[model samples]
Target chain A: MEIRKKRRICLVVAYDGTNYQGWQIQQNGNTIEAELNRALSALTKEPIEVSGASRTDSGVHARCNYAVFDTAVRMPGDKFSYALNQRLPEDIRVRKSYEVSPDWHPRKCSSKKTYEYRIFNDEFPDPLCRLYTHFTYTKLDTDRMNTAAGYLIGEHDFKSFCSIHTQTETTVRTITDLSVKKEGSLITIRVTGTGFLYNMVRIIAGTLIEVGNGKYPPEHIKEILQHCDRSCAGPTAPARGLTLVEYEFL
Target chain B: MEIRKKRRICLVVAYDGTNYQGWQIQQNGNTIEAELNRALSALTKEPIEVSGASRTDSGVHARCNYAVFDTAVRMPGDKFSYALNQRLPEDIRVRKSYEVSPDWHPRKCSSKKTYEYRIFNDEFPDPLCRLYTHFTYTKLDTDRMNTAAGYLIGEHDFKSFCSIHTQTETTVRTITDLSVKKEGSLITIRVTGTGFLYNMVRIIAGTLIEVGNGKYPPEHIKEILQHCDRSCAGPTAPARGLTLVEYEFL
Candidate 1:
């Protein structure tokens, strides 16, 4: 019998996600996880199953998402980024890869995740930025959005902002920061938090948009949070506008 | 017998250009001009022919391209923007429309044209900007590129940079301004000129990239210009990275 040594490798992944079903494995659709598995398996000749830090929804892009997998391949940690990049598709890239402790789990570790929801607020849609930004002709008032975003900071039960289809033990999450700003015709809503429930960020974006259009006051965020009902909040923003821009493990 | 009054309307058009063949109409492939004609014909119930100020190549984008057409639709010149936008696809838009002199022609009018060549300079390609930016893993020196761009200013015979396939009476043109700037991972080369030969901006970009990469010194641009041979110039940058940003009738 031959004994093989395994080392856990973590990757900083960035993907377009427009063509992907989602980050997780699914039988019916092509996904980011499946692609990574295929590429990793081909590289190491092992049946590698990688675990993702965050399972981003369909059509949602990410600049930096983490994933960890055990491999017996002798390739050094940092060199995996360069080597895996050659094997991966153009839309998916391994930005950085390194070896991690055998027990260090990406999802189990405490981390601060930052996401940006982009809104193209203009008289006409710009084709250049159409893929990443959600087009809204109704001029958004950033001031109102910022005021509403402020209320969501700190620990709060985000049940109202979560999807009804989500299955989680608790709906409570701590949002460290939330902000809204506009440059030119692009409005960016950036939020950083320790964790998030299903569709929490997007639903929050949708509610803020309502506040921006003057349909609701900034203080309405408090009421929505207090209601603890999904129906109270605005509709979930489109998946295309959301991007996982940063994921830092603490 | 009923007769109609025709007005010459000039439009500021913007398009993504990713899906279109080019700005010019052809026997095959969908073009921006063809789309405009189809939309205008549908609106006016006439076979309307639009004259474009610049014939941008395939896969080239534009924020402000000019086109003029004669219409007898009884709609006000400015109002045509709103009406035409409804008929056009999401990738194309009419930014502004106004009445011009009946005899005025887009191509015949002396105009200053400005173009931008975008390069995404980074270790890995950004999926978000993949469609609009040319990805270059090589680190570029913008200062060197700017130095090279300075030599191209003022009136010069650009025969060396002109494509061999292009036909024109004169190869002399005045470059009003040329600049290279870097923001984050994006490098933009902005060039404004009285007129340009076919693939002029793209070739300039390619040559500047060589300057940026230290393949040639900044002064090499002058030598290339003096040579007045297309073979002396660098390769034409990809059309997807180029955009006709501004066109102003002087």
Candidate 2:
């Protein structure tokens, strides 16, 4: 009897995420993981499951999300993108796929993730940008937002910026870069970090928005971090404004 | 007996046309005009009909499409934008509203209209931009497209570029400005003209795309214009790439 050795494959996926209930599989609604599993199963003629690197929130988009699966399929790894894309919906696309060592795992790898939160700061909301941007009629001060973001850099206890529902054991994380840039009527907040707690980026965005709108002083972020309480930070920004821009495995 | 004078109101409308069946009222499917009429009737307690400046095709977006309607409602013209927006779907928005003279008409007046056609030229399609842009895997030559567009910027018989089903009496029109620009992986063709025949802009986009792809020489546009036959030009481009950018009454 000959035994077929199963190989591990890594996939870089991109999705609009408007119709998805997040990256994790849930019983109540559609999700990116569920769709990927269904498409992979249909393509390989087996019940396939994939583990994602990030469990993105509902309505959060992703330009590059990492996922790994083990399969016994005989097809070439590079061809998986084309084959899986044929079975996926228009809103979801497999950007790239490649073979990985059997011992490699997505979640256990050291990676740097970059997120972008977009805000359309204009008197009226742009209908064309409604799907990707969070619209605000109030004017925002970019300088103040940038000042507030500076305090969030380096290793710190991010409990105040994490959602209370998170099950993670530790709230310590390191933010490498955080910037607030304004171009015309659009304000973009780009944050790069080693890892994130649940809803950490969204909470940071919400806190920075408060500073931009003059509700809080830029220096107040230091106190929020010291408190290390979820109630110390601002509310979580809407999920629609957040997007995972890049994921670089170290 | 008190008499309320009926005033003609002009609306500057904007919409994401992905889910609409064009600007004109139709019985087959949902349309921008039908939604407007429905909202207007509900707001004014009477039947309302609007005449659009351009009957844009399905999947054609608009930043500023003009529509005029007579209303007996006592609401101020500027307030209509706010009121109508509340009832309209998120894809459609009333940007502004103002009162026009009773004798003023949108289509009858001399005006300059600008349209933009966007193309995403890359090895792979971007799912985030699929609804708003046309995607082509081929690398396009911008210099050739610009040269072809230069030949289109003058008064001439555009029968070669007009759709065969056009109901217009004449195919002659004056193009004020035509330019093709490439930024990153996206190409934008901007055209401003006195008036456009049915499917004229889309046909022009298609013909220029052929020039850019090396299918036709840049100078071939001159011969196409002189032929004055629809078959002499390239096929009409998809409607998703075209957008009505501006409409300025002279």
Candidate 3:
């Protein structure tokens, strides 16, 4: 008797995330994960399920994300990106694919994740940029936002910046870097960390926005972190403005 | 007799243009002009007709297109922007509105118009930028594109760049400036001119793209111009990539 060992394939995925639910499968609506599973099943002539690294919220885009699936088909793993792209919608795409160790799982490994929140700080919204940018009428001071962000650069309990519905065991996380940058009426909040709680980046973005608009001083971030209460944080910004820009396994 | 004289209101209009049939009032499709007229007539209980400075093609965006309409509504001119924005769709916006001379038609006076064509030179299309950029896998040489654009800067009978079906009597036009700039994966071809023929900017963008991709030498632009035939130029690039960025009356 001969035994055939299944091979694991990993994909670098990018999606606009405007039309579907987030990366996880759900009952009420379609999602990026479901779309990928459907495309993979149709292509490989089997029911294939993929494990995703991040379950981003609906309307939150991703420039670089990871997903893994096991298959017993004889096709080359690198060719899966081209094959899957033909079946997937234009809003979602598989950037690259390669074979990985069969025992490796995407979400179980230690990884660094980066997100960017874009704000169009102008008198009026530029219609062409409405989909990708959050519009704010008041001018933002990036210097103040940067100073506030600098206080969140080390290890701390991020419960204040997390959603109350989050089921994570611990809210303590290490933020490796945080910065606010501005150019030509556009403000960007970029955050990188080893891991994040649900809505942590968005709450941080909203809090920094408050600092930039003079609602709160730079030192307010320290107090919010000390409180470690979700009510102490600012609002979670619109999901449309957040994007998972980078993900890498350590 | 009490008289209420109609005032001319000029608008700085911006639109995504991805979902509308350009700026003209076409019978078979929804248009920016039709939407503006609908919003205006509904806001003020009167029929309104507008004169547009540029009738951009379908899928072509505009950041600063001008439109003027006469109205007897007692609403203040500057407040029109705010009022109309509430009635218009999210994809179209009135950036500014002010009173203009009663006879100051948007198209009759000499004006300098600037258009930019964006190309995303990358290995794969970024879904976030797909609506605003033309994706090309081939790397572009901006230096070569700039050199080619320099030849088209002065006055020239741009017959080779105009569309074959253009109804204009003559193709003579003055190009004020032309340059190619690159930032990261985005390449911008900005051209300013006194006037443009039908599809002139798109043809020029296509020709420059060919020059950048090594299909033609930089000096080939002069020969193409002197030929005085539409077939001498490259194909008309996609309308989605072109944007009317600036318009100013001389």
Single-chain TM-score of chain A, each candidate: 0.98, 0.98, 0.98
Candidate 3 deviation (Cα RMSD): 1.5
lDDT, model 3, position B35: 96
Q: Rate the local accuracy (lDDT) of all candidates.
A: 0.93, 0.93, 0.93
Model 1 per-residue lDDT at B61: 99
Cα lDDT of candidate 2 equals 0.93
Model 2's chain B yields a TM-score of: 0.98
Please give the range of 10 consecutive residues that has the lowest summed lDDT in model 2 chain B: B122-131
Residue-wise lDDT of candidate 3 within A1-250, one digit each (tens)? 7666799999999999888788899998999999999999999997999999999999899999899999988899899998998899888888899999998987989999999999999988999889888999987899999999999999999999999998988999999999999999889999999999999998999999899999999999999999999999889999989999999789
DockQ of each: 0.67, 0.75, 0.80
Q: What are the C-alpha RMSDs, in order, of all predicted structures? A: 1.7, 1.4, 1.5
lDDT of 1 at B179: 99
B1-250 per-residue lDDT for model 2 (tens digits): 8778899999999999999889998889999999999999999997999889999999999999999999889888899999999999999999999998987999999999999999999866777888888989888999999999999999999999999987888889999999999998899999999999999999999999999999999999999999999999988999999999999989
| TM of each candidate vs. truth | 0.96, 0.97, 0.97
lDDT of 3 at A3: 62
Better of 1 and 3 by DockQ: 3
Native interface contact recovery, model 2 = 0.55
